[model samples]
Target chain A: MTSGYKDLSITVEFRGGAELLFEKKKNELNLPGDEEWTLRRLLFWIRDNLLKDRPELFLLGDTVRPGILVLVNDEDWELLGQGEYKLKPRDTVLFISTLHGG
Target chain B: MCSVNDAEFETDDELMQPDEVPQTEGAICKKCNENNAEVVLRVKDTYCSTCFLAASTHKFRATIGKSKLVRPTDSILIGHSGKAGSTVLLHLIKAGMSEAVHKRLMYKTTVLYVDDGAVLGQTVDQRKSTISAIREQVHGLGFTGYAVSLNESLHSSEPKIYPLDEEAEDLKGDSDVVDLFNAVSSYTSKEELLHKLRQKLLISVARSLGCCKVFTADGATDLAITILSNIALGRGAQLPLDVGFVDSRELDIKILRPMRDFTRKELIYYLNFHKLETIQTPGLTTKKEPYTSIQKLTEKFVTELNTEFSGTVSAIFRTGEKLSIGNLEASNLIETCALCRAQLDTVFTNTSSLQATEFSKLISAEGPKGNIGKAAFELKKFPCVIDAAENVPLRDSKNCDNCSCSKGKEKFEMSAKNFEKYLCYGCRLIFKDLDKQHSIPDFLQNSVRQRISLDDMREEIADFLL
Candidate 1:
């Protein structure tokens, strides 16, 4: 899949029960760097590749689900551009599910 | 990135959208006005780490202080579920107790974790590991820790609590717990049953430990969902007790939800800022579809609305705070439901929903021409109805003529019809979903029997009373 371009290494972390859908708590992935990447694209990619079950839970329409909080480098994705925020190399993206019961 | 342009760029449209987090790269803390703000809470309220922590700690302390319910030297139990809100609650309690002598909390603290892994379908090893992790967290905080399984609620006697330092024995009657849940018809009823059983277990454990007050970590968002779901479940009468800061439903034991002021977002922020790790505890509807249960559907609704409006949860919570049931005088054990223990809301007027439901059932059971008068007569026979009658003196066991206290016990056949009268409106709905073949928990059965015996005693003295 990565024939033309270098690989963009990044980390994806899940907490607050979001990991249950992904089957693991954290993942390190290398995406093909041929095309410009945004969080919207990253979500679809994660849903296709990493999500093992319940894609509806991790993604709603074209973005991440409402109950799931997305953080980019420890900042709220809302402060960033949400789905429109461009993903850079080595950026740490985290998804935390607030729907879990206390 | 320029501060001058950023200030000029603020518009009414941006101000109206409280759900959106504006650029905080150069924004100063709203509280301290010194350091650059790191967190944006309640929409535009920005705070630095130090200010946010201080404010949160102050809120926690203030909640407890304003209540004046906890006394110095009193032992209180903290119900920890290992979720993010509870993890932060534990951290806050630890920090409070370790503060300076003048400001430190004086109440002794213990932690209790009721593992519902059986109902959540966790394997034995998985349950053990979860409990072990909780044990480590509790011990690391220098507090006494106790663990119990959700199945223990089925036992008549007090639940067996295993110390965190010691190995927990295999819980007997696990099948009974599983059977009880399996018998429930829907996910909504299953969740409600789980909640009630957990609550009963908590109260029983607190009573055994001689702790009068229990701390639960239900945040604003949680309480908001609970408020809506409780109403939908026909528990509107007990809304005050259900979502209040202090739940005195048991009278002797009080359930305090001090974290009711904080949102889930704040809790996650607190944990992240402090680098505290939380265990992911799966609940009944954890991986289920969003609309599988009433509670889950309400949760999804509340959370999604809160995401779009930010103030949605607190608005619901504040509205719930203002609710108070006027007739709390009948809050004694006998006047409460035999199951969930909320004050019995079974008594209804002629035009009430309860009557409408009973009429519908009568028509379905015995044709449209069924004896309505007979059904009304049967409804009036309920103890809650008798208690609600005006000018009737309260009947006590001592006033009975042919008291059964000294006689041999009678075999109690707890039928669904008889059991329905002892439950509140909400519990009646849950009971309706229960399978007839399976017996109820011993605690509930015993309570109902006591109520029945008391009623029998009242009937024996009916002729003598005015």
Candidate 2:
């Protein structure tokens, strides 16, 4: 079985205002970029450099609500991890602030 | 039909005939089961007003344990939205100061109110509502009410400004009125006009009262506000943090806020639980202080932020603190401006506060080859403590009213078309072919509106980027 991912776009919605966008490539579960260092690297470099912290995220074949609050194409990425769980090359990944206020 | 009408009339007449008044079934309130329960507290077993006050008294004493507030002694200032937080804090402080922990009455308290005369909160009606609420909550609780800048306009006459129907005649005059008017227009808005007056009052009190610590209910929401104000004469980073207050003071005064941790919901709940609702309720003053102003926008932004990313905001604040990336002003206490040296509010205070202070180093502009990298580092580095004499201003910002934008010329008073021409290309399209019917919030929405329709007023009004 082949398992790897690439060409993922990451977007973050700030609580105050503005939606941040970032794009990156993946190698197996690790991001191919140096900035994949901190989770913040992706956000800070979204408009500047994608190579610095392109973001590489790994997931077990099975997990639920990873608590990282990640969404792929507006759908929680956790739901896709149960089986046959890996992102397609052209998938978009997003991290949104958890908004619980009413 | 005639027979039916006649029979109906006779029956109506008999039924309508006055019945002699029966022995009165007393005009008692059904909810409280007592005649005198005109105003009853249904939530707490429907008690009379007198009883309700008594019940709240215990909560007040318990919550205000250590305030050690002596009667007619210490002056307490309360700002409505901000003051609400202070009220909660004072109660807690009252608790903390109380000898009750050691079994004794420790303090008597007096409260002082300085109404900012918030333009958004204009009108005698609006003022009355807010004042009444604050008053009602403190009725008989031994508090003094002091209203300042209540209705004073900085100008003896009106100046030229936005929604511009009123200022047309003022523009035609030959007196220094036009330039002075523009100066005033450029410097003050309905909000700034009111705020400055209130602040001046606070400053006066601080200087006069020999204030120990003047507490303004500044919360995290306020922390995120535009620190520098264009209207404030380039006084960069004007509303400094609690620490900034400490830095500004050479005297014994301290400005404190105790309820910086909780969200508005938590605050509301805390007050409700303690039966300590601030007398100043919102919404009643909507007429004078409409929904279009910056303060309203800021309040909405925080509320929306709370709704959108509840815990993240507080988390971000924690991060900024740890990272020390807050809006700290780098000043040159000794360095004088080459041209004008009235102590630059910033290294670049001649401009509005919305302009990022450290922008001079980050110029992607063609200069020395290594400068771009240095500029990037400057932008990325923590907020610097540098030569306050050499700060650069962010040029992207143009409108001064919004905290996020730089204070450029007064464009709203210019030909609407010229204003459109000067906008950033991104924001230009938003204002193109501006419609008279819609009210826009800021340049961002104006751009977004160009692509697609937004909520009704989003086209013409802006919240200012800060």
Positional deviation of B229 in candidate 1, in angstroms? 0.6
User: Looking at candidate 2, what is the lDDT of residue B320?
Assistant: 33
**C-alpha DockQ for predicted model 2:** 0.01
- What are the per-residue Cα lDDT tens digits for candidate 1 across B331-412? 3434789878888777766677877776667657876688867776676554465455521332232224535453323434
Supply candidate 1's per-residue lDDT for B238.
Answer: 91
TM-score of the second chain, each candidate in turn, equals: 0.86, 0.43
Q: How does chain A of every candidate compare to the true chain A by TM-score?
A: 0.90, 0.32
Off by over 4 Å in 2: A1-102, B1-83, B97-99, B102-110, B125-132, B140-142, B150-197, B225-252, B281-302, B320-345, B348-466
Compared with the true structure, all predictions reach lDDT values of: 0.81, 0.35
- C-alpha RMSD by candidate, in order: 6.7, 28.2
Where does candidate 1 chain B have its weakest 10-residue lDDT segment? Answer: B390-399
- Candidate 2 Cα deviation (angstroms), residue B49: 24
What proportion of true contacts does candidate 1 retain? 0.37
In terms of lDDT, model 1 sits at 0.81
Worst 10 residues of 2 chain A by lDDT: A13-22
lDDT per residue for candidate 2 within B367-434, as digits (tens), equals 67756765655554323433222122221233454333323333323334323322322123223423
